[model samples]
Target chain A: MWTRIRDFDRMIQAMDLFNSRLGGVFENYQRPRLSAGTWGVTESGPRTNMYDTGENLEIRVEVPGIKKEDLSVKLQGNYLEIRGTRKAENPEGYTAHRVERGETSFTRSFTLPSEVDAGKVEASLKDGILTLILGKAEPAKPKQIVIS
Target chain B: MSERQDVTVREEALSERNRQIPTVAPLVDIVENENEILLFADMPGVDKNNISINIDNGRLALSGVREVKPVGAVIWEEFADVEYRRTFSVPQSIDVAKVNAELKEGVLLLHLPKAESAKPRQIEIKVG
Candidate 1:
């Protein structure tokens, strides 16, 4: 019963999202529907996860079919941004029977929980997943206090 | 119109395991030539060893699992551990033995070649 209710809830949410999108299709035609997170959409920006370690903040972004050269990461104090482009890969001399993955360009930015040292931030792409390790600022680092 | 019917993809019914680990269908693109049908599926964060592709009795099934482990404390998460599952009904003309697959950068590429008998052939006629 719970699962059925959850299914209904998800169905309603999807319908609402679709309605909102269709509501302003003419006005928002030029501008894309912007969604930073993956709460209710699938064809938008990639999903992300953020974790706060003792001295650093780790972020993981799923970016399948994205090459290293096509991705860029920018960090300024507590603001971070990710920009990527996934080009369509259609082989030559072949007829497309079904095409679901289109050429997509997205820019997702966030205001981090705490300030980070921009100089020490590390980023890597492995298996189409982008990982960013942001070192916390000196004052933001967790420090143990001596007991009196 | 449906002369060169390649394959048909179907969504699997959810079960106990699917409930525990959300099962999502990966986006796929299929293209074909005279030689074989090429399929590309997007399954990010899924390891090669964790993915399984099986073809039997004119049916193909693909399954992959992705696990996300955070470092210390979770601030916010938009994605989590889940499973990618999808099944396709391939035509019998496909040569199952010669099928090959390659995984790169979280994308799975599958090649299904047609059998010898199914390939187009030309005949020659000799006038008496």
Candidate 2:
């Protein structure tokens, strides 16, 4: 009973951590910008979507104005990490009347809900959206029982 | 005058037409220089073919449709099926005929050039 209770406590703690991290990601985008300063570098991460399709788990991340060459994705164990940088450029001889966009670099990580085949993962970037398709690992099947 | 009337008519038409559509205003950055003004809007999932920009009576209207394509049954979903629409009241000094637009990586960039009268002119100094 003690061991089971301890395990349950650990699971709760893990879940709490995940929830806080997810909340932080959302808060970064929602934080109000300071109106007094010239645009500073912003550190908000990309908005992301994760969904399962039984056979594969798909992740879509919104990263507008970033090039494909600037992004990197890695899968370590069950954790998937996405990192990217977007460089800002202001046109020459231009006086900026209103500047809301800035240079940004972000890293976001997520834990998978099920086992994934690392070798079969695929990623692509289109229209500033990064898509990741991860194949699920096959579960072991039980042997058939004969009734005689 | 006629311009004001045109703007009011366009606003009425836009609101009436988009009443039933699910749309969201995209985040935008507007910058102005001596020669032109640049506008950037973030519209993820939008393609070049589905984006439209119209300028009428100093009103710049932008609209984009993003089609979501799912391969299989979705067990979970976070994104929504929302289109994008936004309009800006441009200054009369903008040369609408020379405006240029480009859509890249789901972002829309519009460049509005200044008219000859609005551009800065340098005066030559004569020493006698």
Candidate 3:
């Protein structure tokens, strides 16, 4: 019985140490701080669906609370650049219960395949999802052979 | 022993009830390959005709508003109000000129193709 009691006491002390250390680490991490890099939005590295389609490619981007007129698209060589800004609303003076307003500027780009027809790039925004349709060039299309 | 057993039963019941509550957001699937990346988002009750997407200034943003106006006088209620907001950074390697997106069956599909240099090429063996 004495040994069991001692083991229980030791376990409780270890748990206390772990809890205090964890609390300290969490407290050191600043909350509500502005995070500009990967935290505020999805990372811009190579994504999973980068090379799925062959003839046609579809791209969708997320831009919340941004007006259609505020967006701009530019094509440079093989890369397509999109730029836009969004203004956040601040309802002050009242006791704020919940705040999920993310208003900021964003720019994203993608490199196109050589077979893509850069001349005819189409884009449209509905609701909050932006869609871009890229047509493939003649060489990218499947060839047909006539059988005699 | 009887009191302890009763407390355990009550706790189990409470947890079971909590599990029945539905989550506000649906699942999102992202698939990337050698040539393109596909993003699939499920937004139930969200109309495709009223959706929108924007890419600008180095940011890609996604937002959807879910408005469920009260019908008659609160017949039965189970949904929690929510506003879907998600953003992403666009890489410099994508061919944004040829990107495309489509919405079908309450699911949003985005295709992002990579640049020609980013794709892999096969090498042939030489015969001596």
Docking class of 3: incorrect
Summarize candidate 2's per-residue lDDT along B1-128 as a digit string, tens digits. Answer: 36443234322222122223345567777888888899988788888888899999889999887776775656544454556777899999999899999888777899999999999999899998
Superposition error at B125 for model 2 (Å): 5.0
lDDT of 3 by residue, B1-128 (tens): 36543234322222112111112233355556667766655553356554566777657666554443332223222222334456777676677776788765345667778789777789899997
Candidate achieving higher TM-score, 1 or 3: 1
Best by DockQ: 1
Q: Write the per-residue lDDT of candidate 1 for residues A33-106, one digit (tens) a residue.
A: 43421221146677788999989999999888888999999988798999998888899988998887667888
Alpha-carbon DockQ of candidate 3: 0.02
Return the lDDT, model 3, position B87: 72
Q: Global lDDT of each model?
A: 0.78, 0.72, 0.51
Q: How many residue pairs clash in each candidate at the backbone level? A: 0, 0, 55
Q: What is the lDDT of candidate 1?
A: 0.78
In candidate 2, stretches whose alpha carbon ends up further than 4 angstroms from where it belongs are A1-44, A140-148, B1-21, B125-128
Better of 1 and 3 by DockQ: 1
- The digit string of per-residue lDDT tens for model 1 on B1-128 reads 56532233435334322224556677788998888999998888888888999998878999988888778999877777767777888988899999999887788899999999988889889998
Please estimate how well model 2 matches the true structure, expressed as its whole-model Cα lDDT.
0.72
